[model samples]
Target chain A: MHVGIVTQTYQAKIYVTLRPSVLDPAGTAVQTGFKQLGYDNVGPIRIGKYIELTVSADDEDAASQQVDRMCDQLLANPVIENYRFDLQLAPTAGAAK
Target chain B: MHVGIVTQTYQAKIYVTLRPSVLDPAGTAVQTGFKQLGYDNVGPIRIGKYIELTVSADDEDAASQQVDRMCDQLLANPVIENYRFDLQLAPTAGAAK
Candidate 1:
């Protein structure tokens, strides 16, 4: 009899942001809009991308490594952006099915 | 003698995500792209907005309130998106000057 390997589903929250040295035109534009809306005190706003995804892996370590590889390979533009992620065990794996 | 109130600067990290009932076309497109890149194990991807901004306020409570108002008014679309934020005291207030 062969036993099936159980895989756990993990939820990852990834944040991709422009490097400080890189210019953020979109952020500047939004700040200007805020000022025009009478939020004169708001300034230096920066915008970034937030992604949530589910991955199935054998363990937490495997899940984290997978997320890291995904970010480095396709989620972030290395030259001008910085990426970080947090991984946690999903409350339930049923949704991932 | 008149004393000046020293306002502390707080940094807010805001996340805006689509509601569960809403469809995420961009996320689906990205998931397809990931599969094309050979990340077959990744699925159910959702994309959203992340924002960082500094607000000067008398205290943490005031800063939190300000961030909440900003999210409700400008950072997120209530019709389909939900917003949450984390506020912390900035390491230095000089940047906001």
Candidate 2:
């Protein structure tokens, strides 16, 4: 008897943000822009990166681990930033590709 | 009797991404970096912006509306990007200020 192992595709949405102690000049600039545009009620904006990608793996745990490694290696700078991600099973169309 | 209208504070996390049809050079560059670092399994990476800010409003709906307006006015580029946001009640520490 022959068995087949099908790899599942997971979609990951990763958010990388600066550590609270880090200064965010871009965010501060945007806050100033908001005030100039009459959005005076807006307060204390901090900016970060949002990344979306797909990974094919044997299971959800494997996919999550791979994503974590990727973040540590390249997606985020640990000294100045932190990252969190959400993973979902990719749609059938995406999996087929 | 004085009727008090205390404004509630909401924290908003906004994501702005390029439309699928638009080309993303930065994403492609990052993908190449991932491949060079031996993460060849990664696929179709896209990079975007994540913004966190606080808004003071009368209620949840009011907060949502204000955020949507902010996105249209200054946070996102309507021509080639799409935006979405999640709103939560600010913590007691944040709301107190």
Candidate 3:
């Protein structure tokens, strides 16, 4: 027997980064800090941001599908940044998001 | 033969996420979006942030050391979030960060 009273919920996490061809001023600053610390071997770096989404969907595939669309439409700038995400299901409402 | 004029630089990327015990309002909003979209199976989610650094260090260990300190002191709130980082060396300055 299936319980139709409640549906499944999922959690999604996304990571976004600047494209290799772009500049990262923040990353450069971090490099400079290492130099000042006398550890002058740090390499060039790129900076990025992360986003997490809590969604109600039929399943993982559907949740991923919706979030992917979200990423394409507003989360990442395809011309300058690249992104990846992960999704997991939650069985309880106590899992705060 | 060695040139003391320049030091090696390393690129660092860090991901910061809240502890399971913490609350995430931003993630919750994402979940509600799914509910409104008619896909009421999405679960609770956790939100986090990312950071990247271009550092000049003597070696990977050294860069990691300094960055670890930076995370502890500024990048993450240990009481609510956890962090991890990755580092790579670059041979040329053209690798913008």
Candidate 4:
């Protein structure tokens, strides 16, 4: 593994969520916690997964396409989970704060 | 157990991360994937969890304190994980896009 070097790449953030029609037990449990806390005005909650990845691609469109492939193949379950992403130029290692 | 009612509340987003000293196998695994994909310039990768919730609070400070307490109590493991959050006056339910 290489270290201490920065390279130009694409940064992708993928959010995976259950289909709206599907029940999210964990989300309901959190909402219940709010209910018990007397946050009666609090709204619906959905628990989902967020993934950040860096990949080699020429441009945003290319990076997004690759990320979509990755999501479809392994990152998200198409049967119940839907995924969307945002992309930007990758920052150097240790640059994020 | 009410549904379809939009209310004014505080929206909180919590990001939980492993301490810098802690080894993150999942993150390493993803880094390896990038290595195999020839993204040698791709930098360090860290994987963490993101959580969102709505709560009743008089203001942002109140909402943040409640979220901090929740993080300390049950939302995150203070021993090896660090947590931070962002808060905003909540938009109506289903307003997120």
Q: In candidate 2, what are the lDDT values of residues A1-97, reduced to their tens digit?
A: 8747667789999999999999999999999999998877888999999999998887889999999999999999999999999999888524633
Error of 3 at A86 (Å): 4.8
Tens-digit lDDT track for model 4 on B2-71?
Answer: 6563434778877787888988888788767766865464445667766777876655677678778877
Tell me the tens digit of each residue's lDDT in model 1 across A1-97.
8747677789999999999999999999888878877776675888999999999888889989989989988888999999999988888863444
Error of 1 at B58 (Å): 1.1
| Better model by lDDT: candidate 2 vs candidate 3 | 2
Interface RMSD, every prediction, one decimal place: 1.3, 1.4, 4.5, 5.2
Best by the lDDT measure = 2
Pairs of residues clashing in candidate 1? none
Cα lDDT listed for each candidate: 0.87, 0.90, 0.71, 0.72
Cα distance off (Å), candidate 3, residue B79: 2.2
lDDT of 1 by residue, B1-97 (tens): 8847767788899999999999999999889988998887786899999999988887889889878887888889999999999988788873445
Candidate 2 per-residue lDDT, tens place, B1-82, comes to 8847777789999999999999999999989998898876778999999999998887889989999999999889999999
After superposition, the stretches of candidate 1 with alpha carbons farther than 4 Å from their true spots are: A93-97, B94-96
TM-score per model over all chains: 0.92, 0.92, 0.63, 0.70
DockQ of 4: 0.31
Candidate with the larger DockQ of 2 and 3 = 2
TM-score of 1: 0.92
- Candidate 2 Cα outliers beyond 4 Å, as residue runs: A1-3, A93-97, B1-3, B93-97
Q: In model 4, which regions exceed 4 Å deviation? A: A1-7, A31-43, A93-97, B1-7, B28-45, B93-97
